[model samples]
Target: MDVRVTDDADVAGAADETRSLLAWLTQEDELRGRVTPQERPPVPGTLGPVLDGLVVALGSGGAVTGLTTAVVAWIRSRHSDVTVKATRSDGASLEISTKLVGPMTPQELRAFVTDSSRLLEGGQGGQGGPGPDGGAL
Candidate 1:
């Protein structure tokens, strides 16, 4: 998973905010054992270790769900105007991508992340349940 902030007046400050958000995410109970923050290489134009984004590795299949929810909620609360993108790959062909544009309540955040995760997993809110008229139940 990775998060980057865009459309901010202070580029450096935005980077700092991203770092702060990353720290908060790392501290979340949902991600405590499931996500690991990775060291970022220096940027080409930057002089030091300042980063515009953060990258974390998810531990298991379920980790993606937790990490995504945590990241979106964090960003929504901290920097509502900033754009954030979180990406996760399974070391093969599967990859999960999530984007947030602005502030979202916990309920909205959960719904968004759940929908995205479902799409990424090639499903829509898990297996289809019984529908009206008793068809495709």
Candidate 2:
């Protein structure tokens, strides 16, 4: 995998996040087989004012791993001020190019609700009811 950050005019924190993301990808077991970033040019137009950047993930082999979950999780976990858009090279193999925006997407809001619901469902005490002493609430 080759991840690059071609913009630097945004908040310094954004650049740091790109670095951290690349590091995490290289270190994670699911992504350890990938390669480090190839190029990270600073695109003045892309990053400026509030904060934003361009992120591209490239794959060299037949199939890649740690992408779907990683990408979605990263998007779902980002701050409210950040926005991410992922596009595949050919709508397959999970290759993605992401552009961050000052405002988040409406889809992100839907995802948040869905994730919260899932969490709530999982947090439920299970199928069986509680025992005599308020064992499960």
Candidate 3:
């Protein structure tokens, strides 16, 4: 999975922020060996060098759940608006926003997870629950 992180103009350190997120995920017991920094070609953006993205190795059963949980929590812990996009090799992907996940209810969160799991696991299309405001990819 290619995990991309983006932040608002006020927090233009998206690449740096992604690195921090990598650290956070690395510390999670469930995500320890699953998270690793990956490279993306530099683009014209103030976000800097395009030196971001985490290539998470997601296996079956609960792997997506733990990854998303850790990711959402990391986003919420931040003050700036940060968004995440998780995409599988099959091109199925989803994007979630910190603004959306911060106030999400359990049901909404479940929907996000269900939607994430489906995409991350190689499925595509309609989501079973309310998805993240960041929209689908």
- Listed per model in order, the count of residue pairs whose N, CA or C atoms clash below 3 Å is 1, 2, 0
Candidate 2 lDDT score at position 64: 28
Which predicted model would earn the best lDDT?
A: 3
Off by over 4 Å in 1: 1-10, 33-47, 89-107, 119-137
In terms of lDDT, the poorest run of 10 residues in model 3 is 2-11
Instruction: Compute each candidate's TM-score over C-alphas.
Output: 0.55, 0.37, 0.72
> 92, model 2: CA deviation in Å?
9.3
Worst 10 residues of 2 by lDDT: 93-102
lDDT tens digits by residue: candidate 3, 22-137: 89888888778887787666666645456557888877777777887787788878888877776666554566677678888877776777666666666663322235543463
Off by over 4 Å in 2: 1-11, 40-65, 84-137
Q: Output the better candidate (1/3) by TM-score.
A: 3
lDDT of 2 by residue, 1-137 (tens): 33322223246566566555556456556556553443444478764433233344444432223433354455445553433222233322111123321133556534433432232233232322222232321
Q: Which candidate number would show the highest TM-score if scored against the true structure? A: 3
Query: What value of lDDT does candidate 1 attain over all alpha carbons?
Result: 0.48
Q: Tell me how candidate 2 scores on lDDT.
A: 0.38
